[model samples]
Target chain A: MPKTKAVDLVVVGAGPAGMAAAVAAAEAGVEKIILLERQAELGGILPQCIHNGFGLRYFKEELTGPEYAHRFVQELKKHPGLKVKTETMVVTITPDRKVVTTSATEGLVCYQAGAVILAMGCRERPRGAINIPGTRPAGIYTAGSLQYLMNIEGFLPGRSAVILGSGDIGLIMARRLTLEGVRVKAVLELMPYSNGLNRNIVQCLEDFQIPLYLSHTVTEIFGEKRVEKVRVAPVDKDFKPIAEKGFDLSCDTLVLSVGLIPENELSLQIGVELDPATGGPVVDSFYQTTVEGIFACGNVALVHDLVDDVSTESALAGRAAAAYLKGEIKTKRWLPVKAGRNIRSIVPQRIVVGQTTPLYIRARYPERNATLHVGDGQTKQQVVSPGETIYYTLKPEDIRTADGWVEVSLEGGRVHD
Target chain B: MTELTCIVCPVGCRLKVEQGKEGLKIIGNGCRRGVAYARDEMTAPKRMLTAVVQVAGSERMLPVKTETAIPKAKIYAAMEEIKAITVSPPVMIGQVIKENLAESGVPLVATGTIAGEGCFKPLEKSLGSE
Candidate 1:
């Protein structure tokens, strides 16, 4: 007996940060809103991400993940106070914002909202979270479930492959399983620089020549039910695995792409406050989240290397959950932000001191001209990377009224010395 | 010298290219499209191809792209002419489907939209934690 209904803004996962936070909370007027989506449609994995470098800065053109989710599902069909559902599924959100969902023509439903915008977008780390030893096979997958079985079920998950983690969806499925004829060969990676995006390692593996290797990995995973081979190796710089400089590599599919995890189990069922270095949800500067009216933006709230910055951070968490459901938000006074020196993560882990926010940041290594700073404001970057994501804004004279914590850092670099 | 990187955007910009003395120079480009992407990576290097086609009766595929960049050595003959054409739906997002494709004159289109055959409902499963 679940039938509830309430609403004023629900938004959970329609992807591309829940259709840009339900079209910016129905263009910030947020009458009823709703938006769920457990995928039956509504561009979540941007329609199985058919690639083409998605929207260059919010549709400044270049689109393709289903034309950047068909321009936000056509502006969420011009909001009639928005109500999209699609295959449904939410399954409990409750911290008093309720939600519940599940569908097959509405089998269970519940809502009671008034704010909640979590946009559950992220997840793809599988292969039992990277333990990868061997045997239990069937040709591994998870370069986003083989890019959703080759771009949304036309199905074709193998025929010579090896890819492991050069990210950017294992370098765009090593050029989409080499333009669908497969035979990809090697992409490996355990870091040595290449958490993807250097123009996806120069257009998806140096434009189809494949073999990226880098610090290499894979160290064992033969066949039995259908994998055939894979031993590869070569890590040592502290990454270890140099077992006789291993090497096996026969193939029949393996994929992986190795990262992204920000689905925050419904933002940990309402306790919220999470940012264990960007596993996401710990917000401020209007993306809200430490659980007030409950808000979160793209990639659950952090893993954004761009989908045009997850449609500009889920359209500012759909206008900050429609200005916190129209109480028109005010509370203020936060300011923590940290992550200094060679920084690794920093998404609004609390901000507000004078307002202007943006922040993001994320460089744990790789620099060029560097110098980011942010507590007293600074900017320089002519190249910086933990695989890109620096963006800064912070002004209000960069925390002048400084209540204390602000950090951010990155500092010096070469610039051709 | 030679280096490269500038995949047009996402601020990749590494560039370097050399031969100076008045000809190709380039060098850590931050813009000018990385000096026309290092003068089209030393001559002729196009890209934008995107794929997925099969959609006649529908095991559904549709996606598509190109209406522009192609010759990165004709992307496997434009994915074997977009894996042997199939489109029969009301399919319209930019429509086209294949005009000069592998000939590299461009035209391939359809960045998604389909509406034919039982309209697809079966393959949804795989939602996270794969």
Candidate 2:
């Protein structure tokens, strides 16, 4: 056993969130910051995502996933205070902010940090989780895993395939496979509307002429040694498969892009309160979790639809953690923040009303042409065209009027002003 | 007058389309993207496709995707042509899978890397043959 080293800040997961957080913390004058990643390399899921739609909102230019990640990696590299450990997995994070990790070089190591940030990102739902009954073969893979195998590992998953779920990853993969000289039978979505972006549905499926079967699902999978075929059928509003409407497609692969769940096992073990809605920890406006001195950001806090948001949020978390270490941020009491109609969840579940900071809330459902109003029952502030996520800044006066809790609600429709 | 649904946004606006003196006139679109979408749908619809390619001597398939949208009517033909092709390993990102596929003038491109040394697996038989 080697002697453990102590750092001012310990960041778990070296993806966009971890990398951004480390850089931000180091820039904020944090003398010692360590970034730990489980994979052999950094960049997380971005390396596998070779699409060019990223960085549009942040950088004002479209860049590939790898390119977007490269920008942050380069920034982290320039920060002398930052240390990154690849192929190191953090097994457990204690409530006291003690991080225990295992690595090939350092068998077992422990670190007690003044503040910790969890940026482990999210994981895709697998076939078993979705309850797709069929023979277990090597053909089925999550969209991200398939992307990695094809883009990073230089191996394709199959020649002909039926992709279940219209998630962005799956949609991107659908186009990726088609361009690779493979037959993409169709992209099936159980929802009446696509879960992915409208641009993806058009550019990926429509442009490719890949059939999109909405309100349909894979009823069963048939294969002896490898994927032979998949039985797809229409589903009712309640999502029950209509067996009579089933049709079998002859393909060798089934790619599942169902949904993503935030990776929060470490937070749970560290005694941080979890939000059932977001499946991540409940944080304050500063991104500090319920347990003081422990911060969380990125996909670990909530499943963001875009990687750009992950980097932006992680930078904030890193700044907050560094501030906390310097005793710059202190709050005695915080008020609970509640999600209103049509909102799936809100980050910074708690907020110190007097704190001069803005709160960010990301909605689970996409509301078209809607206005969001946030405040106590009597006084409210409104923002128009509130998309998936909206950030609101509360001044000292706005906080003074708070009766205890803040309510965020959606109002207006397409025609409503 | 014909009412067509625009799938550009969740709003799903029903656009009024009719032949006027100027040409196809479209109304009730939400954004610029919606207007372009209506124009394309009324004239010619295009789509992008992605699939895996069999890399010679590799167990792993190389992920490839289309760089541009092809004509809506030509998608099946493009897929047929893409399905008939295979590439060797050491394929780099943005590599051309098939140039000017099916004469649609859209290039099929590789989205990721493929290792040089691996066995190529057969396509899953579960998805019915075209």
DockQ of each: 0.23, 0.10
Q: Per-residue error at A58 for model 2, in Å? A: 1.8
Best by DockQ: 1
Deviation of model 1 at B122, angstroms: 5.3
For residues B58-122, write the lDDT of model 1, one tens digit per residue: 77788888887777888888898789898888777888988888787779999877765576852
Model 2 over residues A1-417: C-alpha lDDT tens digits?
445678899999988899889889999999888888887656888766766667755676556676577677768767767777777889888888888899887788888889999999899998988999988987999999888877766676878999999878888889888867679999999977677766677667876789999899999999999999999999998999999989999999999999999988889899999999889999887889989999999889988767777888889899999999999987657777777765667777886767765656665444456666666322232322223346666554555344677676665633322
Per-model lDDT: 0.81, 0.76
lDDT of 1 by residue, A1-417 (tens): 697978788888787888887887788688788887876777778888887767877877677888778777777777666777777788788788888998887689888988888887788888887787878779888888778888877888778999888878888888888888889998988888887778888788777778787888897889888999889998898988888979898998888888998888878878887888888888888888876888888888888888888888789878877877778787888878778788888887888776788878888878788788888889888778787788898887777454488877877875232
Q: Which regions of candidate 2 are displaced past 4 Å? A: A356-369, A376-402, A412-417, B1-130
Fold similarity of candidate 1's chain A to the true chain A, as a TM-score:
0.38
* C-alpha lDDT (0 to 100) for residue A37 of candidate 2: 85
Quote the lDDT for A381 in model 1: 86
TM-score, prediction 1: 0.39
